[model samples]
Target: MQPYAQNWTHVTEFVMVGFAGVHEARLLFFTVFLTMYLFTLVENLAIILVVALNHRLHRPMYFFLTHLSCLEIWYTSVTVPKMLAGFIGVDGGKNISYTGCLSQLFIFTFLGATECFLLAAMAYDRYVAICMPLRYGALVSWGTCIRLAAACWLVGLLTPVLPIYLMSQLTFCGPNVIDHFFCDVSPLLALSCSDVTLKETTDFLVSLMVLLVSSTVISVSYGNIVWTLLHIRSAAERRKAFSTCAAHLTVVSLFYGTLFFMYVRTKVASSINFNKVVSVFYSIVTPMLNPLIYSLRNKEVKGALGRAFSLRSWKGQ
Candidate 1:
C-alpha cells in the first residue's frame, strides 16, 4: 500500500466508473438491469402481499419470508437505482457525493448484515417446527417471532456503525474514481489514500463474525432437520419435510456463497471487474430469484398466489 501524500487535496465527490470498457453498450446494459430491478421489486412485493393477505399462509415461516422479502426490496434498492442512473448517464449518474457514498455504504452494510441474522432466525424457526413438531406453536409464537425479528434488525443496525465510522475517517485525496457500480467496502477501501490496514482488518473481522455465526446456526439446524427426516417411517413424510428445507437451503447457499467470496478476505486484492460481477449475483440476482424460489418451491405460497389471482379475476367480472 502507498503512503498518503502530504500535498493532496480532499475529494468531495466520487465518480463511479462503472463498466467503463462497455460504455458502447450502455443502453443494452441499462435495459437489462432496469428490467431486473423492476422485476425484483415486484416479485418481493408480491411475496409480502401474498403472505399478508392470505390467512392460511400466516405462520412463522411466512412471517420470516415476508421480512426477507422486505429486506430484499431495500437491499436491491440501495445499489440498482444508482446503477441504473449510471447506465443512462442521468442526474450526475455515475457521480456520487462523498457523504452520499458513505451513506450508501452504511445502509447497504446494515441491510446485508440484517439479512444474515434474519436467515439464521428463519433456520431456527424451521428447526423448531420440524425437529419439535409438538411444541412448534409454543416455541415460535407471534410474540416470540416479533422479538426475534426485532433483535435481528437491532443487531444489523449496529453492525455497520463502527466500520462506517472507520471508513469515513479515511482520506480520499485525488483520483476519486470508484471502479464498481456501488460504493462497497472493498472498492472504497481501494480508493483511499490513507493506510487502510485497520479498516480492512475490521471489515474482515466483522464479516467473518456475521457469516460464521449465521452459517453455524443454519448448518446445525439443517443437520438436525436431516437427522429427524431420516427417522420418519413413511417416505412421503420424509420427502415433505425435506421439501420445506430445500428452498431455504438453496437461498442460504446463494446468499452466503457470494458473500463469503466478497467480504471475508483481509485485503482488497481481487480484480475489480470480477468483484463487480460477483456483486451482481448477491446484490441484484439473488433478491430477484428469492421470491421465485420460495413461491415455486413452497406449495402454500403457490396456493396463496392462486387464490390471489382468482380473487382478482372474480373482481374483474
Candidate 2:
C-alpha cells in the first residue's frame, strides 16, 4: 500500500461501464428491466392493499410485509431506473457527476441499511408470533410496529448522509471511470482521492453490522421460532405456522444471498460481476418478488387482495 496522501491524489469521479459489454443488447436489457420494475411496483402495491384492508392481514407479520414491499420498491428505484436508462447505450457508460453519484450512494445506503433493520424487526415479529402467539399481539402492538418502522426509516435515512459528506470532501483528480455499474461505497471508495482510512473502516464496520449482525439476529430468532413450532401438536396449526414464515424466509435468503455476494469481494473482477448480478437481485428483482412470493403462497394475502379488488370494482360499477 502507498502513502495515504500520495496515492489518494490519483483519484476522481468514476466512470461506470454499464452491465456487461453487451451494450448491443441494450434493447433486450431494457425490456427485461422495464418488465421487472413494473412487476415490482404492481406486486408491492397489491401487498400494501392486502395488508391494509384485510383484518387477518392487519397483524404484525403482514404489517411489516407491507413496509418491506414499500422499501423494496423505493430501494430498487434508487438504482434500477438509472441502470435501465443506461440500457439505451446512449447514457450507458456515461460519467456520473459528483452530485448524482452521492445521491445514488445516499439512497442505496439508506434503503439497504433500512432493510437490515427491517429484516431484524420482521424476524423479531416472527419470533413473537411463533414463540408466544397469545402474547404476540401485546408484544408487537401497532405502536411497537410503528416505532420499529419509523426507527428503520429514520436511522436508514441518517446513516448514509454523513458518509456522503465524507465522500464529498474528497477530491477527484484522477481517472473518472468507476469500474462497476452503480455508486456503491466500495467502488466509490476505490475511486476517492482522500484519507480513506476512516472511510474504509466505516464501510467495513457498517457493512458488517448490517449484513452480519442482522443475519445473526434472523438466525437466532428463527432458531427459536423453529424450536417453538416443533412443540405444536396439531398438524394443521403446524402447517399454517410453517407457511406463514415461508415468505419471510424466502425474502431473507434472497436479500442476504445477494447482499453478501455483492460486498464480499476478493481481488478478482470475476467476483465483481457476480456481485453485480446479485446486486440486481436485491436492488431490483427481490423486492418485486416479495409481494408475489407472499401473495401466491399466503392464503390471507390472496384473500385480502381479492376482497380489496372486489370492493374497488364494486365502487367502479
> Which candidate's TM-score is highest?
1
* TM-score per model over all chains: 0.97, 0.88
lDDT of 1 by residue, 1-317 (tens): 45546668999999998888888999999999999999999999999998998888899999999999999999999999999999888989999999999999999999999999999999999999899999999999999999999999999999999899999899998889999999988888888888899999999999999999999999999999989988999999999988898889999999999999999999775588898899999999999999999988999898888777796765965
What's the lDDT for residue 170 in model 1? 97
Give a tens-digit lDDT track for model 2, residues 147-187.
Answer: 99999889888777766777787767666777677887766
